[model samples]
Target: MILLLFLVSCNNGSGSEKIKAAVICTSPEAAKIGIDVLKKGGNAFDAAVAVGFAMAVAWPSAGNIGGGGFLVGRTAANEAFTIDYREKAPMLGFKDMFLDEKGEPVEDMSTYGYAASGVPGSVDGMWRFHQKYGSLPWKDLVQPAIDLAENGFEMTRDLASSLNYQAENLSKTPEAAAIFTKTGGFVIGDRLIQKNLANTLRKVAEQGRDGFYTGEVAEEIARSVEEKGGFIRLKDLEQYEAKFRDPIRFNYRGYEIISMPPPSSGGTALYAILKSFERYNPADYPYASAEYIQLFTEICRQVYADRSEFLGDPDFYEVPMQKLLSDEYISMITDQIKFADQHLTSEQVKPAKDLIAESTETTHWSIVDEKGNMVSNTTTLNGGYGAKVVAGSTGFLLNNEMDDFSIKPGVANMYGLLGNIANAIEPGKRMLSSMTPTLILKDGKPFMTVGSPGGSRIITIVAQAIIRVIDYNYSMNEAVNLARIHHQWLPDEIQFERGAMSFSVAEQLKSWGYELNRYSSYGDCHGILFKNDGNLQLGISTRSNGAAEWY
Candidate 1:
């Protein structure tokens, strides 16, 4: 299960009824499946697995068995764990795999074709999670997804629109075109079913991880990729394993922050970004004021500068975690912004320390049971309907995560995020990612579980949400509903949601030499906040076509 928990909430001074458990995700059907698992006496871990699989059937845009992501959680017993199920380059993969004979990168080769895929680890990741901490039968946990795929479900407008928008790319694969764009295009409320996906889910339910990594499923995945000029081989599939690592733990004020580690720049970048504000409390500045935006943007510039220069897969490069998160490093970052009254251009900030190194088509869910167990997971296929191609007869979309690797040093990925040799493609190497699955603990107890889907903006989006609750004492809902902003160092521009800043504030920012880019919105954030009074407050982003269900 992909679990990244962010826990922090205020009671809003109301006597809300206590909740025994909660499930929040991008799909109502998936959320219901998770609640049912809790109702069936399953723990948060079990609910997480159920929800993760159900998303594959209910929300195919980002959720998947053909992709991989990170999971971070804390058990009722106070044990913390993180599973790195990130996809890896196939064994046949090479540094220049996406480059042409002219020594230039072929954009299409790594963004929308078979060569874009990586060896998926979601199946093995969920199985590892279940085996480690789940309290229910593995088969039972996955049955809900199987049922949904087999019996079909009502198509929502968002899903239908997404399918229609991607018709051209998806049409390249006969299987995808047949399943997603049938009858010219699906309308809202149309019944959509996937017999092939249902069959694949059955194999997983019956045989656990082996069902997909071996046997017919594996053969077909490899054959399809190789036949289309991709590099995946049977050996790559058979050797794929999800590794468990210690959660990245840090104390932000009084609350304990837990998040994913290397291969995912989220945790490290988040820590750097958050710690940079230790001396300056954002609460002191009015929301979206010129002062607040300047402070926030400057800090983001410095941290993201570090992210581009020094963050990458730990197994492939030595991430300077100690130095990056060190008190000295954070102090250096904060000191720069503390004295600066104007916007700091990207060119003005560079990774202070010399080092190495990482999509927006991702999904996140949060689950918290009454027992004090909490799970926050972020999973993705690297883009909407990833690679725009389904594995032949498998009924799953493949991830274009390989593009996440820097096709060439200093080159920007699809998300407009830059990287270097530290994140270059290599045989069996995991690509760097920005998926942040986080958990917050207050006084050693579960406080909240939160996560989101926003590609490169994920780290900053998550950080902003946590700040709203922790510093401003906003309710979970308020924190999520509030407009958000992002600033990656390379672009040297600030991206704000349409309503994130007032017109005057936008003009002020521009006057201060900050380029502002506004968009409708991004990120489908879902979180469960455990209140001091023992009530659970669920928060779902208004921008999401999802729900928050609890019992």
Candidate 2:
């Protein structure tokens, strides 16, 4: 169940509820900074930039200047757009790079070092959005990050937890150990500082991408990755830019769904889920009942199967995003879900156990300005601590996105999906992603802002929430907080969150040959569910210590 918890801020100074602009982020300070831009008369794009930069600090594992992501937004006139800034494979990358001595491919390289790091585009991506729609000055957008970096921001409990969790791995990398982990051990509480990072932010603020790619910051990044024997080069830094594209919008029941297109698989994978499930409504079955789980899991299985087989950057492959999401196609896929509890194997679903993952720990942000514009952006460095290769010069973490490439056709990722030839690595090819930033429209007006940060589960979680809100009568909070159950098909097991449901739901389901795994948190999702009259309601899941605020 995707749970949406709305935070209500009742003003004692004035009882009247303002027509406030709201924001949700993995970091509270980041959300505040985003709302500050809105209060300053900036548009949704500016708020996205502010929120993203702040998340890089507070939720570094997921959000990074050294990474890339996707954005889906709506203009004042309700014109929908998608920005695809996901990282690309370096010029040096090749399909055989991850293979072993026996010519067998390995998956760790995609989540590990130089060969693993993709060209970073997040900085250029956010800057492009700002250039097109920002009302606030770029310098102003960069100020909060600069101050937080140089002057220092207090470490919240969540920040402390992330620091401790990644500390050991960081110690293995010289640069990361020097800055993030103190001399004795992990930097915790109030002692952590990012002086060098402040300087890096100031450089970008003062000189834009040139400050990062061709100037001092670029030198720093090149040096660190080079020293580590990784492949990212100065040229890779100079060539990166965020690409903008049209979003793929589909009708789910009656509501419109808009999501980022490739180099993001978020849209295609999610479309499959919606199209597949339109055949059955959970309301038709008891909540958390075996029938419901079986139905949802089958929908998920089919989506992953296709994702593993055909999904890739559209620039490289012809992704039939529209046809796949078509009601006719979905009916064919979803109708296969048996009411009886059962483990649908490769033989059951056919084709494969498709898997896709970009480190499960990432950050998602959504914002809507008073101009009636909405923006949803998700960023990730891939995995906790990323490559653990912090550039000594800039105090920035590099990403591990190179893994999205299909090292060799038929090989499976950790999630268990066999790769297709289309996703194979080539010099400068962008890695495919599942980061689905989305915008929802009610009668051509921005009504709800939604997105998530769960790697491969990002598609499942975001797609499920869309179903809950538009299909069921659950409130936004209830819809988001619902006990979300996940099955990607390949694993042949349904993963459930703790407090999901009663035992009968699992026992009866288990009798049908299903393996169930329980988790505490699936992903950090932040969204704003707006009432038609413009009343703002926000939800921020605690999976990543995320928060929401109305400004």
Quantify all predictions' global Cα lDDT against the true fold: 0.85, 0.75
Best by lDDT: 1
lDDT for model 1, on a 0 to 1 scale?
A: 0.85
Query: Could you tell me which 10 consecutive residues in candidate 2 have the lowest summed lDDT?
Result: 6-15
Residue range 1-551, candidate 1, lDDT tens digits: 11112322322225444566888898889988998899889999999999999999999999899999999989889999999999999988888888889989886888888899999999999999999999999999989999999999998888888888888888887988888886677789998799999999999999999999999899999889889888888899999999998778899988899999989999998898888766686667777787887888888888888887777888888888888778888888877774324545688788785432225668998888888898999999998988989888999999999998878887788998888778888899999899999999999998878888999999988999898899888888777778999988878888898888889888887777778888778888877787767787777777856576676
Query: Clash totals for all models, in order?
Result: 19, 15
Candidate 2 accuracy as lDDT: 0.75
Local lDDT at 43 for model 2 = 83
Please list the residue runs of candidate 2 whose C-alpha ends up more than 4 Å from where it truly belongs after superposition: 1-6, 9-19, 183-188, 341-343, 352-357, 414-417
Report residue 322 deviation for candidate 1 (angstroms).
0.7
RMSD of each: 3.0, 3.6
**TM-scores across all candidates?**
0.96, 0.93
